[model samples]
Target: MQFLSAYAAALIVFGILDAVWLSIMGRLLYRPTLGSLMLDNLRWAPALVFYFLFPVGVVHFAVLPAFAAGSLQTALVNGGFLGLLAYATYDLTNYATLRVWTLTLTLVDVVYGAAATAIVAGGAYGALRVLASAGWI
Candidate 1:
């Protein structure tokens, strides 16, 4: 029950944050930068897979550990590092292999990924703490 609650919290937080980020940055940054490479319609299958799976990684790598340690800082730092590594892998690979990929996009996305993941992880941890305190979880 506790694990499910934590996972749900992390998933909800991460999905909301990432959706907002994509909605905003897809116009302001990605579309402008990637232009033709930007698909008119999103590929939902892979996107859904990523959204679902990413939170599991977050819960396992960041939230669970921090919850055990009873330290929000642990969640934030570990989440950020995980985000950095994941985003950097994608962005750097694209920059290296794709002609359309740019340094600006890579840098912005990498930073956003780290920040967003940190926020999501911390938010989930905090929510769990609140629930536990309230005897809800």
Candidate 2:
């Protein structure tokens, strides 16, 4: 139950942060290099589903341990590591298989994913602590 709360909080916080980042930077970062292969319109349903599911793994493997350790640093480091692994898995696989995939995009995404996850995990931990203090969780 506690984990579920943490996950939900993390998802909400991270989703908002990610949405802002994408809205501001996605086109500048991706459209030029991959325009030919880019879909005319994004399939938002699956993309949103991916956002929902990916955080489950992030919260489970990274945030939970950090909470146990009682350290924000742990959350940041572990979350970044896990995020790198996850993004690398997706980006590398696409890079290997898709002719349109660019190394620049892959590298940029891996870095962004790591940083974003670290920030989100740390923020989630802080939010959970605040909630617990307020007797909300």
Candidate 3:
């Protein structure tokens, strides 16, 4: 039950933050740079897969460890590092292989990923703590 609560909190936080980021950046950033490569419509299946699975990664890698250590700082730092690695994997690979992938985009995305993941992990950890205190989780 505790694990599920943590996972759920992480998923919700990550999903909300990522959705807002994507919606805002889709025009200001991605469209200007990667518009040519952009699909007319989103492919939801892969996106859903990523959204669902990434939070599990966060719960396992960041939230649980932070809980074990009883430190929110652990969540933020580990989550940020995980985000850096994960986003760098995608952005760097694209920058390496795709002619359209700009260095600016890669750098911005990697930074965003790190910051966003840190926020998500911290938010989830905080939420779990509050819920536990309230005897809700």
Candidate 4:
């Protein structure tokens, strides 16, 4: 139950933050360079898949570990590293193989991913701690 709550909270936080970032900055940043590859219309299926699955990865690789250890600091560092790795795997692969990919986009995305994940994990962990203390967990 605790793990489930933490996962749910973290997913919500990440989804909201990413949506804002993608809307305000991501479209402008990627469209110019990857215009040909960018979809003309949003595809709900794949977008939803990525968004949902990505948080699961964070929960498994980062959040759960910190929660198990009872260390919010662990979540911060591990979550950030996990996010960096996850984003780098995609961005770096694209930068290497995709001619349209740019360093600017890659840097921005990886950095954003790391920061966002760290914040989400930390916030989720703190919230869970509060809930547990209040006997709400």
Q: Which candidate wins on lDDT?
A: 1
7 Cα displacement, candidate 1 (Å) = 1.2
Pairs in steric clash, model 1: none
Q: For model 4, give the 10-residue run with minimal summed lDDT.
A: 54-63
Query: Can you write out model 3's per-residue Cα lDDT over 1-137, one digit (the tens) per residue?
Result: 66788888888888889889989999999999997899989999999999989988888999889988989999999999999999999999999999989999999999999999998889888988888899997
Superposed Cα deviation of residue 43, candidate 2 (Å): 1.3
Task: State TM-scores per candidate.
Answer: 0.96, 0.91, 0.96, 0.92
Query: Candidate 2, residues 1-137: lDDT per residue as tens digits?
Result: 65887888789878998999888777898887788787888899999899899888778877788888888898899889988998899999999998988899899989988899888888778877777778887
Supply every candidate's count of residue pairs whose N, Cα or C atoms clash at under 3 angstroms. 0, 0, 0, 0
Better of 2 and 4 by TM-score: 4
lDDT per residue for candidate 1 within 1-137, as digits (tens), equals: 66778789989999899889989999999999999987899999999899889988998999989999999999999999999999999999999999989999999999999999999899989998999899997
List the candidate 1 regions with Cα displacement exceeding 4 Å.
none
Q: Per-residue lDDT tens digits of candidate 4, residues 1-137?
A: 87788888888999899889988885679787788787888899998898888777777777778878999899899889988998999999999999889999899999998999898888788877888899998
lDDT value, residue 7 of candidate 1 = 83
Each candidate: what lDDT? 0.93, 0.85, 0.91, 0.86
RMSD of 2: 1.4
Name the regions of candidate 3 deviating beyond 4 angstroms: none
Off by over 4 Å in 4: none
